[model samples]
Target: MPKLLVTAFDDEFCDEVVKVLGSKGIHIHGGNRVVSIDGNSQVDSVSLENGSKIQADMVLVSIGAKPASDLARQPGLRIVENGSIWVDEYMRTNAEDVFAVGDCAVKRDFFTRKAAPVWLASTATAEARNAGTNIYGIRVLHQIQGTISAFSTQIGGVAFASTGMTCRACQKEGFRYVTATAVAPDRHPGMLPGASELKVKLVFADRSGIILGGQVSGGFSAGELINMIALAIQKKVTVRELDMLQIATHPLLTSAPTVHPVINAAHQALAKLRAVGRELPPVKKAA
Candidate 1:
């Protein structure tokens, strides 16, 4: 394994990934920029902007990428700063009868409503379907205003997943939120064969109790668990509602009957919200 760094918007999730990578004897140089890559035709060393260099036989330089909007620009279409074609919620471009989808199209954050730089085939396909359905007029009842950006990755067979926003993002966007984390065994009895620990984190808005986002890391089930959370965010599921969410549990497939990590995390947030409510000044009854 060589030195690597994974940079993203989610700080806590990135920290968890760094720990997982560290456990696998992989060093992560996070929050640093690659100033130069000293390599020939094959490979060489890499230097960072922070006066640090990593000697290497082969280096993979993946700084970043922007949308290739050259073709779209030829038709005099609007382009954002990232060179992506500007499109409305229905993937409709400013030009009449012109539509854009996929990586070349602009994206917005689902919760924050800000211009998002997320590029994913899932988003692309969803946009494509919306655009295809609404070519003439608004046939679909809903349109994609922003992307939730659900994603999952694995390291050493340990899967990590996240959807929607993180606590770091909530703070940066000035959203009033409450967050909680819970860890439970993925399999019942805690001693089942192939059982792994599952950790879940959920964030909710303080006032409305709406779920903002969630993150999970554990066995292969982590991937699906994240999609559930993504759906919760999409449907505007509240913390109180999630705390009471019901699901069937089995010994071989899931955590203990008393320890569903997602519901448990939601319960923790609900508890905090109750405590905060107790501390607030109460209103006088209307006479």
Candidate 2:
């Protein structure tokens, strides 16, 4: 029998991708690297480093792109270790009056301030706007500092999106964190047309309750939903504040206000923090 295998790095987003694709009859061979492709006249199969062979009529490889910095190098522009043009926060190159943006420019991590290999059109657009406005001088007081790595995609009729860091990433980076998840129908009533179960998972700092990341999986709304989470991460919103957020909802358009997935997930995180006897930031009383 023939099969489709998708090998990917072990991460929360890729795990969700595997689950969604698996439900649609696609197999995922994650955490396995393909060592070689065996063929005669046409493509035959791929051999995994673990001594496993996957029969394949075709192979689709999706390695990430490398920055083409040859042009920038010609002018003695500083190139980072990752083969991308070194650029400041305003996308200005080391050369006088020269700027680089998009995939060719290096990006830094929002939290770590280290060089990050995140190349996306959305990130590039933000860089371009900053570079354009600051061409003459540093007119823009506030500017993009680093890449958040917000990403979203649709697979098997389900929209899966994530922003900021994942639990695995937190562990690897030695961050003390807590996570919580909630599920609710996208529409107020489960019987509404096009209603889908929206699942939300949130990660927060262990004691401070500061939101570190979020993941959403559901209908088309998940795309915008992840953007909201990205904003929350950027603003360093705490679980308590997120849980108390006021939201607009309608029976046909959104889930019940009482059971909104994002808010509920925050509530769950707060409970987890409390259960662990972690000291949480005091909530400010509205004047």
Q: Over the stretch 1-287, how does candidate 2's per-residue lDDT look in tens digits?
A: 01222111125556667777888888877567889999999889999877999999999888668988888899899999679999888888999999999999998887777788888899999999999999999999657868888878788998878778778678878989999989999997877889999988999999899998888888788889999999999878899999899889999988899899999999999999999899888765777
In model 2, which runs have C-alpha deviations exceeding 4 angstroms? 1-13, 284-287
Worst 10 residues of 2 by lDDT: 1-10
Q: Which ten residues in a row have the lowest lDDT in candidate 1?
A: 1-10
Best by TM-score: 2
Compared with the true structure, the alpha-carbon lDDT of candidate 2 equals 0.84
Estimate candidate 1's alpha-carbon lDDT, on a 0 to 1 scale: 0.83
What C-alpha lDDT do the candidate models reach, one value each? 0.83, 0.84
Give model 1's clash tally: 0
**TM-score result, candidate 1:** 0.89
lDDT of 2 at 40: 92
- Quote the lDDT for 118 in model 1: 80
Clashing pairs in 1: none
